[model samples]
Target: MHTRRPFRTLALALGTAGLLISGCSSGSSSSGAASPAQAASVSPSPVPAALKSYYAQHLSWRDCGVSGFQCTTMKAPLDYAKPDGGEIKLAVSRKKATGPGKRIGSLLVNPGGPGGSAIGYLQGYAAIGYPAQVRARYDMVAIDPRGVARSEPVECLTGPQMDVYTQVDQTPDDDAEVTKLSGAFKKFATGCEKRSGEVLPHVSTEETARDMDMLRALLGDEHLNYVGASYGTFLGATYAELFPGRTGRLVLDGAMDPSLSSIELNRDQTAGFETAFQSFAQDCVRKSDCPLGTTSADEAATRLKKLFTELDAKPIPTGESRDLGESLATTGVIAAMYDESAWPQLREALTAADAGDGSGLLALADSYYEREPSGEYANLMYANAAVNCLDLPPAFATPQDVTKALPSFEKASPVFGEGFAWAALNCAYWPVPATGTAHRIEAEGAAPIVVVGTTRDPATPYHWAESLADQLSSGTLLTYEGDGHTAYGRGSDCIDTAINTYLLEGTPPPADKKCS
Candidate 1:
């Protein structure tokens, strides 16, 4: 369900909330003071019964665009437990198959980021990027989740407030700075409640997964056929758990393991960034554009760290009042970690930054933040925080927990540990109660499910693929010994062929499929 675009748009440079971390603390739910009676009735159900009727009414589609595409809306109960209560609208789009043969069904595609816009993916990529033959036989579809774009989105800070938030130091120098950083996170959280309170509590991934089933029913598909990338893998796997019997051909790439808590997720992700940095370092040593010293990767890392520190103290002016500083620079580097293809561009940016020109690096940071030249933000970051905060509670409950866990994160990536951990602090003061927990998904009754892993994937670690494969009753592990986030469309002919064969026919690849 995710696409790892090599180059980012201005706003995408900030992050894709595709993974979680562990060891962060927690607090009481933030859903606010419900009466005891109302609270008592609010139990998490295994499956909401109201979803069936909701699905039935939502399947009808109307004209969307070009000849084949259709658009519609699906309604989900604001709270799954109160299914017949207030509802939320989810926007749906589909491109019907141009088939000369029997149609398979709807194949839902998600482009990673628990918050990424499925509608955007459908319009921009899935409409054309999917294999033509597959497009010919099955309807390709997308649905923007509850608090994502097109759906009722969650907005926290305004443009000016966000500019300030983006500039918050990810790595604090001492107790005073840590308090300042925590205050920023609290402000963002409070802003969400103040600006978008109504929809904030309903954006959990579990809720989204249930919404997907409603989409499946409306589409009249007997089973759910899906291809999920990055965080999309998590959503698909969750669906398999809830509706194993209704699970069809499912593919999860850049896999995330449900068994791992937030801390573990963050630590592993930090290590992944390290792996990617090492790969970049190795390649940079052989390239003329390399910015860091060529003595060794260690020297390169040290030099980069020094540069980051220097920028932290005296940020380079990018002509704009909002210029590239150390925190944004660090974020920009981490964004490149998502795809190895961006290495050359990263090298260029680093070289420019080293030469006292911060525009290149600033541009990269702007892309991550999805910031436009005028300083407005795309809905990406807002939706990301909404979905993430709703899906899982805070990774760390308090600043003290972050301080205690710093060493472990530092061990993961000496350069990025502190920043990532601080970023995890955003959910601490979430407006809604966290509805899900870290649990393994067996997806026991499903048909054969293919799990693909890119060995050096910075977003989702390779070990997670192995873990998920081992956990699933009918999971098959497919390995791509390459550098990148996901493997299928990144030029591994073997990988493409294997998945294509599986989707076109009913056969999976060889059990031990490997692509180098």
Candidate 2:
């Protein structure tokens, strides 16, 4: 059926860097006052002297390859438990405010892949696309968390190897195919251990959150002002939980519920994608060019399943040497479901594939894998599995586990069920045992935090935002009654205005505000 993108968000177009710059300034005190009762409820261990030294060190910034963006490297302990043990270099990037008025402090933005490159996101999108008024008031900053791009990345397969990995038939028809898929997963996991064994155990979200605190201190900000999407939302929440007194103006869009086990998360995500596909199918049938017929969503789904079966038997050839197989074709469809703006493109790809041309759909799949025309790939998928595997227990510990859960997963989404069920096995073969566990994050004394949820987000379901908001001690839920992966900066003036007001004025919207 459908394949999932390992990472969360798509890359924004890289734009020309500007020539505006501003200075970093220090400040104290968060927007919301922490109640004494809230403060007393959770007493955290004091920062060790060695760790404090790491946090207090200054960053030496210099002009980067991008015009206005400055880049620097910060050292973080590989293991927080042993501050003096070993260190990892983190890549940091920033674009200072271009202001006509007073500056507000630094504002950090993360485009959530868990593996997504925050530095790339900042220079490519946030620095240029964020609200100008907000940009004028704060230094837009991003850091590539350990084991991600630009920092010391987690390397697994080579481009050609990854190509073969992505093409593996996810819906195995027999024991041999299932064994082959398991082999593929084992090969991938083994590759990560061989290449990145040192960093694999320390790349969990909790460690990344700790790194953010160090970044905040180095940037001289008393509190963190941040925007996180998809997996990044989980990260921002972790920071709030770990550093409640330092929490400030956090916007968590497309949020994830930390309390979910891997099994629940995967099952929920499968259902989410099914919901998104229903929406797409309903809209697709209305168009004359739609290849899946205009009868109904069920009919469209049946037609799609038939197409996938056909591709499984005989893949269609593309302009490039690579052919469009069931796995790639399914991934292409899933990618388009992330943003409705891509629906037209998905339709055209489907029409071409139905007519024997597979280039368009292959291109979409290529983009999802970050596969360059030269057959090169970024480390996104590798890092995605690295962090995801270490953050929580595996969804399936063995093929038997997947077999037992297959029925329930299929019930979640008939079209994507089998594929996702097999895909969840990727983490089961991981070499490193999970270092973290699913738990509630109260961030007891944290300031007002804004959690934005789109009604039908495929990756991070809406109910997750509701759950997270309810879990956090001071979380406020902001609902966008629409479709898409995230809400803010996607053409809703209402959402943009509310978020901008929150970041600039330190006041969030009403606790349960709903925007169209």
Candidate 3:
């Protein structure tokens, strides 16, 4: 779910919730404590005088066009190590409790993007879609992390350039095709360096965790109460690791394990998508209108791969200028796997694409890119790559690396393996080295942290939640025995009640609780 392209859009479905719903500290200061190198570390020292100015600076809130939502901006150090070096502005938004009870405090919500706009999520979903009791007692809040939307966003390719990049053949048959794919990756990285090099180095989840603490202090919350989905779960975990004592009522839905290397993460995610796709195929075959043959899931998968091959050989024409090539078609299929609700759309898109009309699949791919009808795009994909590339080393350092690893990737996912392996190459061309490495996050001394996982979550795998929960000292695992990218506010009343109880009553559900 946390991949660079279509995976980044996992938060989109969760973000449309008004209708639906919505690290480490510095190191070396404590003996026997997990070092920064071992986890998403946070600074242990008290706020420095220079940084105190930023932490204490007052925000000027104003109407952000969303009724009942007040927005403001906060300043954070571009480099946390150098508090006085330079500053970055983070966009913050809040909707006060509509209460029939005493206000508890601010409940900060982030829809995982690493690149997703928390402020946009706050105003659009969390403000109105959360449970009434929880909303009545908590100030719903969100902050667009630095380099995300409304913040000083990271920008890379223009719409046209992105279209070309997205359409590039991913499953290359030979060295020339591989080179072309590599060139596309290089182009994307080069664009980021040219447009957002300065902010690129500082957009790691570790930096964003520190920013969250500052927002926490500014909002006067003694403890940080939060709900983070997908990549946001990683952010929440990082914050807990950094400020364990400050963690309160945290719910990490669609959790990610920070301990996996880039290759491992990519492999696991590829397998996850395969798992989700299998589930989709099983359901699809049962439906009469399944485009990928109406036999077994395995047969459907074969048909799907055949479609990719066919598109690779001969791109389907969309009414729009963009045609449905292998890459775009794959992305469209991947997009639908994020949520089951989109399955119908995927089926329709596939049916149309098979009929030589590619508009449906192209539209789905565009939605995955957060592309506007006018061909403009949001900063989602740009920021996704920026943060992902900076946070960890590239999954593959070269095309040869991808070539060598192709078999294992293919074993993990026969349908998506080649493309994902190639897509993982994007970070290889990054202008900067990774700022943080993968490590276990125990978040020692933290309060009970609820980690929620959907069994069939395509983006963030269920086992990841288990791994993360096991790593956190106070982590509790809550399983939703169902499908989707996230569990909370997604129509599982059981999941919702458990999360709401923890948020409002400061009591986590049973450590091994499972909700169907």
- Candidate of highest lDDT: 2
The C-alpha RMSD in Å for every predicted model, in order, reads 9.3, 4.4, 6.5
Clashes of each: 29, 0, 14
Total colliding residue pairs, candidate 2: 0
Better of 1 and 3 by TM-score: 3
TM-scores of the models, in the given order?
Answer: 0.89, 0.93, 0.93
Query: lDDT (0-100) at residue 62 of candidate 3?
Result: 64
Q: Which stretches of candidate 3 lie over 4 Å from their true place?
A: 1-45
Q: What is the alpha-carbon lDDT of model 1 when measured against the actual structure?
A: 0.75
Put down candidate 1 lDDT per residue, 346-411, tens digits, no spaces: 898899888777887777777676677888776677777777666665688998898889899888
Model 3 C-alpha lDDT per residue in residues 1-516, reported as the tens digit of each score:
125432323445433421211111121210111101112124344776878898878767666556676667789999999888899998777888888987888888888766777876776667777889988988888888889887898999898998788888888998899889889888988999999989999999999999999988788766788888888899999999888877777899898989999899888889999999999999999999999888899999999999999999999899988888998999888888888889998899999988999998888787777777888777888898898998898988888999999999999999999888888888999999998899999998788899998898888889999999999998999999987788888888999999988887778899889999
Candidate 2 per-residue C-alpha lDDT over 1-516 given as tens digits, one digit per residue, 9 for 90 to 100: 222332344435111111122353332222211212222233444667878889767787777756677877899999999888899999888888889667777889888876778887888788889999999888899998899887899999998999899999998999999999999999999999999999999999999999998888788776788999888899999999888988888999999999999989999999988998999999999988789998899999999999989999999999877899899999888888788888889899999999999898888887777777899877878888999999998998999999999999999999988899989999889999998899998889888899999998888889999999999998999999987788888889999999999888888899899999
| Stretches of candidate 2 exceeding 4 Å from the true structure | 1-46
Alpha carbon deviation, residue 144, candidate 2 (Å) = 0.4
Residue pairs clashing in model 2 are none
Model 3, CA-based lDDT: 0.82
Lowest-scoring 10 consecutive residues by lDDT in candidate 2? Answer: 13-22
Q: Candidate 1, after superposition: displacement of residue 361 in Å?
A: 1.5
